[model samples]
Target: MTERRHDREFVRTFFTSPTAVEGEDDSAKMLRRAADLRGLEAPDVWVPDNEDATAPSMREEGAENVAEVVADSGADFPGEIHPRVVWHRDDPAARYRGFQQMLTVADPDRGAVDHIDGFVIPEVGDIDDWKKADEALTLVETEHGLDRGSLAMSVIVESGEAELAMRHLREEVGKPTNSLERLFLLVDGEVDYTKDMRATTPTGELPPWPELRHNTSRGASAAGLIAVDGPYDDIRDVEGYRERMEANRAKGMTGIWSLTPGQVVEANTAPLPPETGRWLLSAGDRRVELDDRDGAWAYDGDRLSLDETGDDYRLRVGGDERRLDAEQLREELLGLVEYVPSMSDVVDSMEEFEAARESGTGAIAIERAATLRLDGVDVEISSDRMWDEATYQAAMTPIRLFQDVYDHRPDQREELEERYGEDVVERATTVG
Candidate 1:
């Protein structure tokens, strides 16, 4: 028994290191360790990983990869849920990864907040029709469920569109039915779009630009697009990177895309983790406070912002601190605000979304408009919306049946629980 007590204490050490990344086995060990530390028995099972792990929601893998968690920013907090993920499919538009920035202004007339999920830069390289090559946005409101944002037109100078997107989003904030859940941005140039992308229509802003989040914000924007090709002849080395952050912080380009995984941590961290100054990957669910909305702001595990001054908040991961600007004064400071989603909702949604990919009926189309727009010619559009019709039809058989299954949220909950287990199902919640 005495030895058992020592074993219990040993296990608790890893249970709350506050830096552990949860995986299939890791979470279970954590739960068991936590219980053992307290001389209690862990639940009969371990926590699940991903959507299949829980009721579905709190477990949702954002609408797209590299998403900003709308729920608790804290990865370890009891009530944290990963919100919707989003992204923009790679196209010629992606080439301008760093040079493009969309300033969306909320439509003042709508009197509602137009939360921006992400932005797309048009590939004007050859394709013309603005709409065809333009960026599409996804803005979520509790009412509309999860749908597209209001603006998606191509722009001439990056500055003009950037301003307008902001106006439109803010304008829609006051409307009666608008809770403007803010945004869900997908940042990346991680992957390129190809004719073979016969899966689900690529839904996102850009690819992962872990560097950009570290830049300064124009306002309360969640995700943003920025082009960072400064002729700073100095930014070729590690010191150059740090120097660039200081300079850009002054100008407001937080981070850049031309980054490596190794560089990610240095650009995202505050006090600069001993390992990497970047904190986005290194320190998650850690407490932090940086500048935002003018003065010093705080993110109470739930809402993030400085409605006033001196709000003591915690760093919950997801927010990046590196940038082209503001690297001058290095303070071992704060980080991320958070959001906790419902237990099964996100998981259910993900399962349904995956099933929907099986539907071959919704393919990409090159309408007469697109034909008029394309110059390179060989424009092939698929109705599969990215799903492999043959495979989905082969496995699921009934297309309609599978399509319908994608719409069922509750069923996904059960599926998730049965597959991944309960660790995911029992994450932190803001519902109460």
Candidate 2:
């Protein structure tokens, strides 16, 4: 596998604020502010937007603004910087303008090239169109005397053809002459996609294309690229943005395009596991929260009971009681206890697994026991989860992500210390 030039662990938020605005003395004000952000406010990937976000007449100045802002302040900014340049599949003039802009911003003398990670190409058509964009970046890199395949190319899937292009990426990227291996992110452009599909809603708002998001995630996974959902237009609707993120997270898409600093803060923090662990139990039609005490979850409510047989226990549900043994009880509780593991829990589990591994234990099963007061009976419950090498590696991802944020956002140290405590913060940064 080819190693990535950029060493980003996890990209939770991709912030794309407009680069240039008309009539403003400082055309790059937004871009400058984004570069100045530190701590929790900073996004994992920052895109200086010169495409749809900027006016057509101001795109040239917008490109200059991208180069100037990053050249001035990007060194201190602890995030990957990628400028979004304009490009259309059918418009040769627009493509040429975008190519020129890329050349301007990517020139080594501009000083921004050192901080720039790649370029984001929007409105791509098919696999061929995507290759054309890749080829353009190669030409730019060659002209600027940079290393070949250094500048990664990310594309926006705005049309059906562009969405379909993702299916062929695995095959196309394996070719010797193809630089599609440098592709980084597959971002969705919902607005234009809805237009292209002639999709309409009663309110005329863009419909939630869950299928598109799923395809993007699958494509990214197949090609080993990062998948990012498109921008949430209602910037003030914080809950709505979070709901959208939850849906995206379910589909294995953790990154989202952020339009403002506030959205960046929300997006950056949403994907990380919760700070504390809690349990939820499924009731008739709803989920009930169980109390956590002394590292175990307990519940004492509703119509339920437990009857002990000779060698098995019967758990009551509404009116049905099923006889279950200890192992079966563990399985039942495992299904019932939807626990969102805290950072501390993950770290502790990982440490235990590591120690076991050092001791030559190939695998281990962890047991979590709890007690429930159902009706008049006090019944004990437990769950066992198996952990192996593969499981440990998967669990290490969030820890690595935490370390990445802690390393990059020095300004957020105090806040992180407050949330996770000094010891946890230290271990989190050092453990993985």
Candidate 3:
């Protein structure tokens, strides 16, 4: 079966740290905490400066030394958790050496290379640097007998030139390599970027770098790569951190680097927009309705037409269409609802959900009920029944008002308050 991409999708809380002794154990402890956090993917432990001048002479020895410390600290966790070592970007030959050392320590039993997932290259100022890093990594992989796609690589976009380089690499040259998966935006690069832009503010607030943040996100998305926001340096300012995280999340960033353990919870708990829930529901419904039969199917103003040709099926969905075998179609359909739990599982877990299912309500109806309950709306009846019953509708009057307020349509809110009492406007807006 084709792996469901949604299985890989979640709030990525990457806890990064320098390889220093003072907070090394503290960092590991946070990694363990992150592993246990619900709705969070495996934590990424990023160790920078693996190939720099101050790094150990033998890269394999350095990796093993770090592994020993990680294990000794009792922070090791199962699943996809892995450490990414950052390589120096100035010299391709040095990076190649580091990659070779990284591979030499790839002993699954020792939890060395097995847990060392990828490498990060810092200060990639142009497409040439990116291409060179790719070539160096590829050469190392070839020499060490590592699979070409086994290790993921990410570049740090720390300056204006680095941002432009990313755009050029994506548009002009394509991905530097197949293994390069993410472009990390270092918004707080102290030396080159901050100095060049004169971004420091007198008030000491987070600098207004909307252009940098937005462009980094756009460039990553355009290249089909994950965009990771840099750490918020002011760890004590929780509210300010949250605001910045929300801004980045809105800009299509998949993840953010957490400089401290305190930031992880806020990072994980950041609310997705209400529209995301709506899209998931719509997509789930479409997936459930998909069948192997060759015919036209329509849902949510989108149409999917399937035609059988020999052993293959030509499937057309909206503007994009492709041919695939029956197995492939099944996998495609499954991918859409991979993140969504099965209706049976939902019913088994929640009494309200079970009651809704027993009443002959569909998945979408149950989803609506669950969503409403999560939004603090009391859902005693199934969504379908609530729509039909006048008394139930009366009970949901406040909820509908609040939803309208949350939706933020001025015309709709004006009409709603005029129809219902204006008192609802205050109640709706203030309830949350």
Task: Kindly list the per-residue Cα lDDT of model 3 for residues 19-136, writing each as its tens digit.
Answer: 3222254433333343443322333334433433123543444455555544443234422333444445566565666565455444344445555555666666667666666665
Worst 10 residues of 3 by lDDT: 371-380
Candidate 2 lDDT tens digits, 1-432: 233334664578889888899999898888888898987788888998899889989899999999898899988887788899999988878788889999999999998899888999999998999988998999999999999889988899999999999999888985887788789999999999998899999999899999999999989887888889999999999999999999998887889999888999999888876788777887545677777655445667765555667788888767767898877865775676576788888888888898899999989997756665444444566667899999998888778778867776667678788888888777777764
Q: How accurate is candidate 3 locally (lDDT)?
A: 0.48
Prediction RMSDs, each to the true structure: 28.4, 3.9, 20.0
186: Cα error in model 1, Å: 10
lDDT of each residue in 1-432, candidate 1, tens digit only:
111101011100001111123454342332223222211111111111222122223222212111222111222222112111111224433322211212111222222223222232321221222222232233222133434434322221122223234334344433444323223211212223221222244674333323322321332232232223211222247666665555544443433322322232334321111211111212344444322222222223332221211322222224533321122111222112222223243333333445555564343221111110011111111111232344333323122222222232232344434433455433211111
Candidate 3 stretches with Cα past 4 Å from truth are 1-7, 20-62, 69-101, 104-110, 171-192, 196-200, 203-206, 272-432
TM-score of candidate 1 to 2 decimals:
0.23
lDDT of all predictions = 0.26, 0.84, 0.48
- Candidate 1 achieves a global lDDT of 0.26
Pick the TM-score winner: 2
